[model samples]
Target: MTEAPATIMLNGKSRKIKQPCSATELLSELGWKPTQVVIEHNGQVIPRSETGAIMLREGDQVEIILPVAGG
Candidate 1:
């Protein structure tokens, strides 16, 4: 079987995920809702629809910023 693409970092660590994946798919894999997390690629906020359109590649920097409610 062919190898999948290398993992993209969540914050500063390497993340290993199978290939043929998109931003939406990644969130699904983590069991997180699109509303719960914010995705930043190359320092840009990508829209939800763009998730499916944006295919991940090796050495790509992905920062998944999420919100937490607390008082």
Candidate 2:
């Protein structure tokens, strides 16, 4: 039997992933560099060191904040 895909809210948009993946995997899938943004998983801040072990679940809300440079 095939497992159901996991659905998560990314940057306020609904997204469906093939399977449950860690935050690190998610970033890589999105083509984002770990140092380019700050991650907030399920309303809590996720440190870079912990991202690799943090498994994203269905219905999880993720906020990726990117720094802007302007004067």
Best by lDDT: 2
> What are the C-alpha RMSDs, in order, of all predicted structures?
2.0, 1.4
Model 1, runs deviating above 4 Å = 1-3
Instruction: State the lDDT of candidate 1 residue by residue for 1-71, as single tens digits.
Output: 86677777767789887786788888888898877788897678998767778777777788888777878
Tell me the lDDT of candidate 2.
Answer: 0.88
Deviation in Å, model 2, residue 48 alpha carbon: 1.0
Candidate-wise lDDT, in order: 0.79, 0.88
TM-score of each: 0.79, 0.88
**lDDT, residue 1, candidate 1:** 86
Which residue pairs of candidate 2 clash? Answer: none
lDDT of 2 by residue, 1-71 (tens): 66688999999999987665888899999999888888999999988788888888899999988889878
